[model samples]
Target: MVAKNQTVVTEFLLLGFGDLHDLKFLLFAFLLIIYVMALTGNALVIVLVMIGQNLRSPMYFFLSQLSLSEFLFTSNILPGMLWLTLAGGGKISIIRCFSQFYLLAVCTVTQCLLLTIMSFDRYVAICKPLHYTIIMTFGLQLQIVTLCWSTGFILSIVLFGFLYRLEFCGPDTINHFYCDIGPVLELSCSDISSTKLVTSMLSTPLVVCPFVLITATYISIFNTILKISSSIRRQKAFSTCSSHLTVVCLYFGSLASIYIFSPKIGSNTKKNLSLIYILVTPIFNPLIYSLRNQDIRGAITKYIHLIGTWQLP
Candidate 1:
């Protein structure tokens, strides 16, 4: 299978944010702070959901899972990106590149499925309040979370297999900070039309179908809220859905901007847009939820007080 005349590239040079040549250190510092805050925020959400008695509902349980997904997703990319930024661009082995892409893809699909499930959870809670307990039972929640993660891994493995089979014969310079599918595919010497087709087919269901479902679910949710004649009750109902809506808008907006409409965007602009979902969304999740939800705020207060009591000497 080896071609004697061909030279396969074993590694790639990531250009990173090299255009800002004089600001590499500043960029590195900024990313480092973002990485720390994101990890702390997501970890806080997970801990609060786990230990806080008031946060034992299906919604909080799902929030914890989302936080875990965000935790892994950000951790997968940010460290390497920090290194790339600090080093003013760097080399990544093909295996490392593939592994990073695989992990990112897995997390992306998992979060998408999780968000869709969360919207359905909200729909059932708001639209069918009496049957919410009966429908979203603990066992069912576990199954749904499991299914999301399992499907994400299975789909990403298929993509990984295709990526592994692609031959990169020469000129392996990736124009972006990470081994995003687009940039990686651009470097392949092999015919990747089929890869693109398969990717589009796989991605449409995961991305488009879930987004469509979320939109439909929210439409029904808003309709149910509007039917409530009591203004206080309407406000209460809207409050429950607002945080999730904010996150969905931020996540899907950045994702669509980068992947769906990125063909018309410049490379540097795409990289900047990529940071919204990658760095900004994770940092915002805890703030949005904790700041807006009385339950989470009360949990945080109770948690801090409990810790203070335990520290007394």
Candidate 2:
């Protein structure tokens, strides 16, 4: 009926931070600062891990990969968001919008899989200390990291293939600052029941399966920790996992709220929740690791000393 009258939409008007006319400058400045901080923090973690010989381990390797994922994740979303906030909403070409969606999907799925792998690394360290080195060898670590990235990109391609078939006819305004699955799907004029089902199937592997694996790994890790005879060993084991646990809680909490509860909440609430993972979590990752991780702290201290002693050109 109404679908027949709809014109094909080639561009979308992103309703970013909608109508924040008075505080547009203020919000823009604030987000810019947060964006810079997120990049700097994640980039620092990557650099630290790369240069610090003492920090070369399965744990730090995973941490560096996670930092890289966070960097890519925020980089994909923030600059355009900043521009839209400053310009008071803007039009995005359909091609660029879909590209952004694809990159974000890849990064998000990669992070979920990486986190699960990281939890497994911890489980082996604590639960099977004797086999940790052999099990998480450098070659195996590289393979796992490769698998995470390849899987994410492959799944994103499949999902985007589904999205590409849909027609975006009229009503080209996206309610959020970004081209997320939910908002993008809502804009489609074509039947999305099959698309929705496929997306759900994809999400089960990307989101729910990884979450379940991480939970089970952590449960096993905790059970192992409780069996340790030495209190110091127990404390050390918990300390090793605490930073990851914090990130897992923040990541999964924000994601679950968005996917599970968005229907019950306002768009504004969903947008704000999106910030928790997209902005805050990335920035907090390095801070949590640096502050809580003795190895990272020591590496930073050493690096600072080296920098301090270097002669100026």
lDDT of 1 by residue, 123-213 (tens): 9999999999999999999999999999989999999999999998878888888889988998888889989988888876777888999
Off by over 4 Å in 1: 1-3, 19-22
Error (Å) of candidate 1 at residue 108 is: 0.4
The all-Cα superposition gives candidate 2 an RMSD in Å to the true structure of 1.6
Top lDDT hit: 1
lDDT per residue for candidate 2 within 1-313, as digits (tens), equals 2366678899999989888887999989989998999899899999999988988999999999999999999899999989999888899988888899999989888999999999999999999999999899999999999999999999999988888888988789988898888888888888899989988888766677888999999999999999999999999999999999999988988888887667799878889999887788888889999999999999889989988999978
The total of clashing pairs for model 2 equals: 0
Reference-based lDDT, each prediction: 0.91, 0.90
> In model 1, what are the clashing residue pairs, if there are any?
none
